[model samples]
Target: MQMMSVSALNEKIKSLLEATFLHIRVEGEVASVTYHSSGHLYFSVKDDRSTLRCVMWRSNVSRMRFRLEKGEHIVIDGSIGVYTPRGEYQLIAVQIEPYGRGALALAFEQLKKKLEAKGYFDATRKKPLPPYPRRIALVTAAGGAALQDMLKVARRRWPLVELLVLDVRVQGEGAAEEIARGIAYADTLGADLIVTGRGGGSVEDLWAFNEEAVADAIYAAQTPVVSAVGHEVDTLISDFVADLRAPTPSAAIEMILPDANELLRTIDELGEQMGRRVAQILHQKEERLRREAEAIRGASVLRRLVTLEESFARIGRDLREVIRYRLSQFEGRISPLERQMTESVDLRLRRSGEELRSLSEALRRNDPTLRSKEGWAEVLSEGRRRALESIKVGERFELSDGRVKVRAQCLEKRPLK
Candidate 1:
């Protein structure tokens, strides 16, 4: 009405709306929600008769505990603002919360529903915790009470286990991502088990455990994971997805580790029982030996032994008699055989002597030395017997007749006609 330019008129409306609606709150059912890649949230709040457009910039949206989903009742705390280019007024949300519930609680229920549908909480898929873990990857805040409690319990229960403290933020903004990354890294550490948790706190303080990222990490762990968030009454999505759930950090340590003192007591009992059993066995053996010795000392046993010896002596006498009788029978049977053998041996010796004498006579008759006894001799030249004609003239020769020898020089050759 006052001849204002288009930009100035729009600016005036924006100024009025922003001033009047500053630090206001509105509750409605959400619709047309869009989570932009730029991290801004674009959505609408609608009622039966009216609708309002809303936007939460990335900075504020990043701080929100839960997502803005369509048809959800939400309360946004912000003021009206104008997009001057479009001259559109919208609610710029600075803070948002679920209409009737805490944002973290709502987020917890939402994530629980989503992951449950995805089978994150199925008992069949849960890994069985180790009875005695050799190494444990403790995923928690480094200096928090949770870590101290777990360590104390572990030391008291099982000092043998190797605890690898994987420090991570257990609460506050971005804590869920840190926890998830910690779990993933712990899986690579060859730990027999993983225990992740923090000390008790408010729902917001423990909200990281309720995050979907933490739940997914727990669900995907190869190592058996034990969720021990907050106190006994508090539960998180991690508890549902983990292989096991403990009421508290200290309880997780106790749940997974054997009690060293109890084990020592058991060992002592076993050792005593073993010693008693050994003593009992030795006593049994000694009693058996004593009974056997008593039996041996009995008069009846001595009598049996003596009777056995007498029987053995009688058997020996009978055996000797049988041996003597067998020898006599063998001697009787061998007498004729001995006589015939002696007679045959004497006849053979006599025949052999007669043949020997006959052979001697024949050898004497055919003896070449006998010719020498009848006046024949062998002539030799140069140590060999040769014809007189073969002897070279002037060569020396020898002749022997029986017991006589003659040496002569061959001076002439002579031939017999």
Candidate 2:
């Protein structure tokens, strides 16, 4: 075994580590922190299972955007180094950033905040979605769930709308460039709307949407663009830059396309309401017309006399002929009825006179006064003969007819018994 002093060995290790890891990147959370009077930062970085010590000199610390604290997740760009005195390996951090997110994430957030300050996300600036989009451009991968889901939704909701799809890679290198070009191309085609999105994935997988190139592309697009990346929980730069942000790819279609059946039903209901309104108006007009007619009829009595007087002066010859014709027809109808009534009255008077004469003859034949007028002398003789038989020789009696009475004495008495 080759024997060497500990100082010599430590120096050899330091030279080898510095050369081998001259530049590198590390991601972890800060477990502990220390700030020195000389403006140096010292902290331990750890993951779920292991830890590493990191240091930033005052020269590099001035370049950092954030201060290091215990339990803060961060990424360190540095070289691996060995401390000869302690014989330990450590990271000499050139740059330090919040770890869970990469430099791209930080950039994304910075741009978002900047755009927010500029009012890019203001509701007023957003273009209204076309109520009936006739042409649509889809910027997404050729064979992906996002494209398929959106297609299904578009077809189901509104099949008449034309969908123009531009295939583009959504992940890996050169993806952001392709996406930006696709957006520009789709817009140049005069599409009514543009939709760009992908299915859910890791943050790295969705990094293309976070790129500034994509955000600028969306902002520059003349046509309205809908951003739908990953699932509901995922958010990216394109979401803010675009005119609208949908929770998912399919939801973008749902927002832009209206259901045809629902529109038809609404049209039918409006038609029925219009018909009812027209009918009601017509009925009201009819009632008003009837009232006007009645008013005209009531005025006819006074108006007709004045009208006849005026018209008689203007066309009296013509109207007089028509009136004469009507009066002659009325006379023809009344003549027979008048003659019949006159004849009936005369015959009734004649029959009444005959009945009066017969009744008078019957009353006289039974009258006692009529009998007194007949056989006056014969009655007086009969009564005198009866009295003489009953009279004694010296008796006196009164004998008379109805008109004359005489007083006499019995001169002889004859008893024939």
lDDT tens digits by residue: candidate 2, 139-196: 9998998999998988888989999999999998889999999999999998899999
Against the true structure, candidate 2 has what lDDT? 0.85
lDDT of 1 by residue, 249-342 (tens): 9998988999999999999999999999999999999999999998777758777889999999999999999999999999998989999999
List of clashing residue pairs for candidate 1: none
Q: How far is candidate 2 from the true structure (C-alpha RMSD, Å)?
A: 36.0
Candidate closest to the true structure, highest TM-score: 1
Q: Which 10 consecutive positions of candidate 1 have the poorest summed lDDT?
A: 366-375
**Which sections of candidate 1 miss by over 4 Å?**
1-8, 84-86, 272-417
Clashes of each: 0, 1
lDDT for each candidate structure: 0.91, 0.85
